[model samples]
Every structure is written in structure tokens, then in C-alpha cells.
Target: MANGLTVKQQRFVDFYIETGNATGAARKAGYKKPNPQGSENLAKPSIKAAIDARLKEIEDARVADAREVMIFLTSALRGELKEEVVVVEGEGEGVSSARTLQKQIGAHDRLDAAKQLAKRYGLDGDGELLKLQKEKLKAEVNEMKTAPSDALHINFTFDRRPKDGH
Candidate 1:
């Protein structure tokens, strides 16, 4: 039994680690005792609970993997941005990564502006901050057309859902 799991749980775990499925793994782990009715007696709640927990672990692992990827990509982009990734108001999510250094980082005005706009709109949009960041990036690039590498500013905004759902 690996990881302090019971023999049965170990089998289920192994199958889960391989196939990432609880019900399927449990079935494969010998939950096939057929009754006189010719149906498998696989209605054990303990087995179901174990499978549910294993599935949750698998899902959590997947989420962690995606978060790592996001960190890596953000770091890479920050590195490319180099000294141009100025923080006019607040810290960025992944701005401090080593592989991707930034320049002219600060905080004050831009952050306040974003907060104000988001507050005004009640901050309800699903990805409003992301959209606002993209717009701010575009504006920063445009403003620095002549000295594009000199610096960049970023702002974030959020929107609230309309009252009537329009």
C-alpha cells in the first residue's frame, strides 16, 4: 500500500493515478462481485468516498499545474518587457519573477485610477480587470510610439452587471 493507503485504497489510488478516474478505477480494483441478480455489487459508500477524494486530489493537481504555467508565462513576458514594465500604481501579479525582470516599477496614480473606475462600476464583470489591463497596455504603447522602449504604464478596471441584466 503506497502513501499509507489500505490495500484496496492502494489499488484504487494506483488506478486513479494512472487513469485519473475514481469510479473506473474502483471498478477495475475488483468491485465486481456479482449478485444472484447478475449485477455487480459495487454500491459500497466507503469505496465511493475514496474515489471522490482521489478525484478531488487529481483536480487540485491539475489546477496547481495550470497556476505554475501561468507563473512561468508571466515571468517570461516580464523578462521581455525588461525595464519598460513600469508600475505606475501597484504591483503586478507576477512582476517579481527572476526570469523576467521589469523596469521603472512604482505605484500610486494608476492604481488609484483603476480602483476608482472599478468602484464606480461596482466591479461586477467576470474579466473586467484583464480587459482594462489590455486597454491600458495598448494605450501605453501608443503613448510611447516614439520611445516605445522607454517605459510602459498599466491600469486595471472592473465593471458591475447591469441592473436589468442587459
Candidate 2:
């Protein structure tokens, strides 16, 4: 409404969030058929801003914020959580014992979680890693392009006879 979106435009926002696809959302919103540029139209500044506002509203209602995510990941990585198990013995004279088993997060799991946190906080050198990977891939592509065709060809002859003297 603030963006002056029409009824159909508002419906498009709802469908977009539901489908996570702009073209499909436009179709579901009862927009014109065969609208190949539906996504492009949605990319317009006003439309994009409306969508962003709607998404923020939905996220604020349903999703956890960054701090909550960090706390959860930190707890998981630290293995501070425990699993409760109840053991029962005998049916009539049942004896129940409740036990809490500490969940041990493996080194790999902790490393992965830490890496994710680092990435979220921009502490990981992801840009450098990406640059290195890009350079490596470019080098490989150049090598392939400059490689001699004969280098890829192999000739083999097999003398299957016992070794000249059985």
C-alpha cells in the first residue's frame, strides 16, 4: 500500500513468498498469461522494495535473528546440549531411571560450525579463498587451451605372447 502496489501486486508478494519464484508468483497472482518478463518487472525498484518490506515482516514474525542463530550454533558446537533417556525395568514393578547423556560434537562438526560463524561475521578469508580458486581454475583452463593435442593421445601395443619363451 505504501508503495502504491495494486491488489494484484500485493497478491504477487504473497505468492512470491510462498513459491520463492517471481515468475511463478506472477502466474499464481493472476497476472497476464505468458509473461516471460515477470521476474524482470518484479525487479523494478518500487516492486523490489515492497517485496523486501513484506519479506522483512514475515521474517520478523517467523524467523530467528542473527544473534539467536549464533547462540544456537555456539551451543551446538560446544556440545553443551544433552539428550535425556528413560530406562524402564519390569512391567508391573517397573523401575524407571532417567539419564542425561551429553551430546559430544565431533571436531569436524565444531570446525564446520566455527567456519560458518566466521563466514557470518566476515572473519573467514572467503574472498581470498575465492580468489585463489578462481586463479587456479583460470590456470587450468589456460593449460587446457594451450595443451598439445598429441599430449592427450596415447598409443599402445600389447604383445600377448608369453614373453618370447613361456
Query: Model 2: per-residue lDDT, tens digit, 49-159?
Result: 888998889889899988988997787678764545445445455655555554566778778888888788766899568778999999988887799976765469987
lDDT of 1 by residue, 17-130 (tens): 676555676677665531221122124555456666777887987775745754544444344323444334434874453343455323443354455445445573635776
Off by over 4 Å in 1: 1-6, 16-42, 65-70, 80-166
Q: Candidate 1 at 159: error in angstroms?
A: 22
TM-score of each: 0.31, 0.40
lDDT of the candidates, in the order given: 0.55, 0.77
CA-RMSD of model 2:
11.1
